[model samples]
Target: MSKISTLQVEKVNTHIVNWLITYAENAKVNGFVVGISGGVDSAVTSTLCAQTGLSTLCVEMPIHQAPSHVSRGREHIEQLKKRFPNVTNVEADLTTIFDGFKTIVPIVSDSDKVNLSLANTRARLRMATLYYFAGIHGLLVAGTGNKVEDFGVGFYTKYGDGGVDLSPIADLMKSDVYALGKYLQIPNSILEASPTDGLFGDDRTDEDQLGASYDELEWAMLEEEKGKISENFSGREKTVFDIYKKLNTINQHKMNEIPVCIVSNDIK
Candidate 1:
């Protein structure tokens, strides 16, 4: 086991909580907003927000693709209520909303493409709901991405799950994240869940699809930057290698700022 600094970790969490409250205050909102997906990242964020003495609202926005996530989401919300008695449990069904919108949004006939599109559409629709509620209730949306994910293969959807007024866990790595959860007393159920986007079925986990565990990928990323490379790795190394290559290839648009048409130094 690595010699992780518990005190330093505690300080970081404290800073994060303080920052979140300040962000909500600056946004002219009474508290923070969040989406709990029966996953650790959101669970931690929601708990921290509620403990910050802010009026936190945790919205469970699972779609039809994965009802398991909905069950888990309810479990998490109930757990959050026990841990942070101040957070509101807002259950919203995004399935009908997405279904209604799908008609106007033309999609390719490809089944795989359609599934991917639906997965992403659900995320964006949920975010829209969060923002709408945040606006009406005077709250700021809290993002739940972590360092391991932020550095590894792009996991979050742009403008969809990625839309947030503040992110509390953007610096903590995955291994370190579990420890924080323990310290915060987050329920075992959420902490133990195989991390996922819940964009599809129950089996659609992040590690399986991303082709690598968060630990290995994060290590590779940090080492590569320091001109140090680990040649010896398990079979999983190949998975990480392939995923890193694939993300670089397919998610290239994420590497650039939003599309800006470069033209002859001429303004229209």
Candidate 2:
């Protein structure tokens, strides 16, 4: 059962398509360039971009990505191409680049730290790849982050997946994204697959990393918005609420703007 309410699928779809088209026209860009991760967010975002009748480039930057993720991503892209003439795709197998980066970086004693850092590195590498295509093609990099990940828990890596010219679905919850994905007629392979960032080069899911399900997190976010505290809950609800609060607190760095030092006039 989803904690988020059902969306008006057709109206939401039309609104997002129009928004993407308007943003692109104002920015004077050719279209949107989305990183397809074989997840619901990317599927919906790329589909929305495609509906604008603008050139939507779905770039697959796989850095030791799992086989399932790759296949699902390709499936969605192929379906998109067949459905929309404005859609195109390119796969940049970044496994070699990622390995080369590890060889050059200094060896660290902490295996855990190194593993996490490398995972984020994979995302940063993909970000650079997306910008590369965006630069040459005059397209804006469309972010695939949803509301629960982007605002609720800040699950994205800083300046990695977090870096984007515009976000088409950041305002929608994970369930909302799934709803949009269904209405967009995305591949069942993607619609049914467990949500994973595919940054860690393994099958560990987003729930495994977050220690909570998207539905639980969504409920926690709503409670927090209502000024509820952990003291008000008990059992698993309290545990999940605490998890959400802790992540929301720690990831404020990613959610907020980069801090700038304001030089006082007297200092000069």
Candidate 3:
């Protein structure tokens, strides 16, 4: 993939910041509240929110989170506070809350299903925490999803990380997010860290679960948009295209709006 130039980066930065300011002003909200995940996406998003010079709250809700994730999240928050006076941070440790939830929930025989459900629960807990802060402070919850995850593969948990008042960077690809992160001078620790949801309480990466990397998925998405099929490629390319197609097919529920049964006037 081609790298984004410096001029493009500067333009995008200014554009997103101005857009955020306009949205907040029109919505009659004070500012934005973003979840800091010690990853490039959240770091870039929080930085953009801070640039608006509005109240930006960086909340860290860790539930059995990795130590490295905690350290990197705190590092970025401290750096953001120093750079923008409008930036503030809070840590809501949800470890005990998670444990309590597990104890109360009934046990299941399928361990894999149980584990997946619990991982999603972690994301939902964080989403609720962010909304609580947003409600008390009159701020909008800013989402940190990129295009590849949000639309291409439907990688995020529905109503979990997907639950948000507004999405700031959902249109940008993963590579574009990193380019913007570099332009914003985000902490290197976060920039270099592997992308993970950190919901499973382990060191598994996004690739480990997705069976393909972001770059590969991005390419597959573009190819599919151009009406290409898996037969058009061979070797690892074929494998990646198949993987992307399977995920995109199965995750349509997350990507589409909730189904609502409409009744005719006669029936009513």
Candidate 4:
């Protein structure tokens, strides 16, 4: 049972497709760029952008620790080309650059922060690569984040995957993201693959981090979006909302286009 009303889903999905065309034209870019991670979000974004009739550059950026993930990303790219021949793939090993940074920055033993930092670094590096190509070739970077992954949990890194000229899936729930994939006629092979960041291979999953399934995420989001929490909420619902609020503040920093400065007019 989806919290998103049928009318609401239809309206939002329509807006998503329309925005793809509008953003591409308004940005004066003939195409879009996406770092496909073999994840549902990226695959959906690439297909949607292509469906809008814009050429999309799908990048496969994998750290050396997980080169196999790049192969998965490549498979998705091949899938993208079969549907939209305008899609192109780029293979970039982010480990080299991260290793370079490791030299300058003291090595840390904490896997939590280290993995988080490395994951974010990979995201930012992918964006940097995407924009470099877009800038030289005249294209827009199509961000691959959904409402469930981004707005609800703040799963994306600021200025990394979260930063983009347009967010085609920003308002969508993850369940609906899958639903939209079906609506868009995406291939089953690409859709059936596990959703992963490929940051660490210890079976680390998105739901493991969030402690909620995509269906549960949609249920909570609908409750919050519609202000149904006043009716009643489970213990887990409260936790989800608390996490949502915390991320709201964190991504607030991500959403800001410029930093606020306390200036005494500087050296004047």
Candidate 5:
């Protein structure tokens, strides 16, 4: 697509800020509770919420989190507080909670299965923590997921990071989030930092796990959405398209509501 202009970015910023304020007001909520993961997506989403002039509680939920990653998240909150007075910070370390689960459960030797299960558990723990704060304060849990991850590939864990009361950046592409981050003048350290889920202990980035760049995946997603995949087949283009399709098929469940077994009244 075309390069996003400064005016367009500003407009988006204003739109999201206004939307957050209006959404909260309509819901009769006090403020927004967002999990600040020190990633660009969270940085931008929290910044938008802060700009709304509403009370924004930026929670840092660390479960076996790296010191550097935790520092980045705290730094972003500190920087945001300087500009936005309504911003607040809270750190909830869930490492103990996670370790408790491991201690009780039988150790599984399957590396991939065990790692993924723990990563997802971390996400769910953070989700629970965010809601806990939101519940006590009567606030909404603002999600940090962007379009490419939430919709294009469903990269978020189901009922984990994907569980939220509101998603301010869900419609924004990853590139667009970067543009907004720059527009809002987010902390440069966060901007320069690699986007990782911080779920894995290995420091593997989202792209590393996805096996493709956000730009490539986004392009393929856009093409897939337009239903033009069958138009032509080439080398790299075809490869990207195939990868996008595979991700969609694998993650389609996440994009939809939870499935339930339906029963007939007569049968009951």
Candidate 6:
């Protein structure tokens, strides 16, 4: 059972849609731009943006994307267009762009390092693509990140997925996002689909990379937030908490704002 209620879900949906509309209007921009990755977060976010009746651009920037994932994204956009006239779906295939980047870049032997670097590059490339459209048209890049990924473990790449003018769902947990997705009537295929970064060339789910399910992570986050870490926690809980802490510590850089060095005026 969900910890959140139906009314809470509706409230969040209304709040997000209103915020998107107000933010875009106050900024005097044409609209909001989002990159659709066929994940629940993106689907829900883009849908909410479309509900605002703004000229929302949903771009699918696939870099060696899985065909199933691509189809899911395209289908979601098609459905959105049928419902929302302000929605526009565009495809920016970045496979060749990525290949061109890899050609001139220095090579590394460490498999993990190489993969991590390439994944981040894919995210930044997608960021650039969103901004490219946002720049040409006066629009702000809307981020598709949830609370757990955005603040708990900093799962997003800095200045990549994290680089955005606005994040409508940053306050929502993964489960909350799911609830909102259902409330927003996002496609069932996307809600049932395992969330992925789509940065890896292969079919690795987010849980495969994170070492624990979103449920486990969310539980750990709740416990940590409540300052309720206890010795009586089950083995599974302990393990999840340990992993969560390690990730949080390692990725704090991504969550925190950039530090500036203030020059002292006093002469030494």
Candidate 4: clashing pairs of residues: none
Model 6 over residues 90-146: C-alpha lDDT tens digits?
889999999999999999889899899999999999998999999998999999999
lDDT of 1 at 71: 74
Query: The CA-based lDDT of model 4 is what?
Result: 0.72
Give per-residue CA lDDT, model 4, range 84-106, as digits (tens).
Answer: 77777777767788778767876
TM-score of each: 0.86, 0.98, 0.97, 0.83, 0.94, 0.96
Those runs of model 6 whose alpha carbons end farther than 4 Å from true positions after fitting are: 1-7, 230-232
> Sort by TM-score, best first: what order?
2, 3, 6, 5, 1, 4
lDDT of 1 at 201: 49
Clashing pairs in 3: none
RMSD of 4: 3.4
Residue pairs in candidate 5 whose N, alpha carbon or C atoms collide under 3 angstroms: none
Model 5 whole-model lDDT (C-alpha atoms) = 0.88
- Which one wins by TM-score: 1 or 4? 1
lDDT, candidate 4, at 33: 82
Per-residue lDDT over 87-150 for candidate 1, one digit per residue giving the tens place of the 0 to 100 score: 8877788777877887888788798898888788888888899999899988888888887565
What are the lDDT scores of the predictions, listed in order? Answer: 0.75, 0.92, 0.93, 0.72, 0.88, 0.88
Weakest lDDT window of 10 consecutive positions for candidate 1: 1-10
Candidate 3 accuracy as lDDT:
0.93
The prediction achieving the highest lDDT against the true structure is 3
The TM-score obtained by model 5 is 0.94
What lDDT tens digits, residue by residue, belong to model 3 across residues 227-268?
A: 999999999989999999999999999999999999999989
Clash list (residue pairs), candidate 6:
none
What lDDT, from 0 to 1, does candidate 6 have? Answer: 0.88
lDDT of 1 at 126: 86
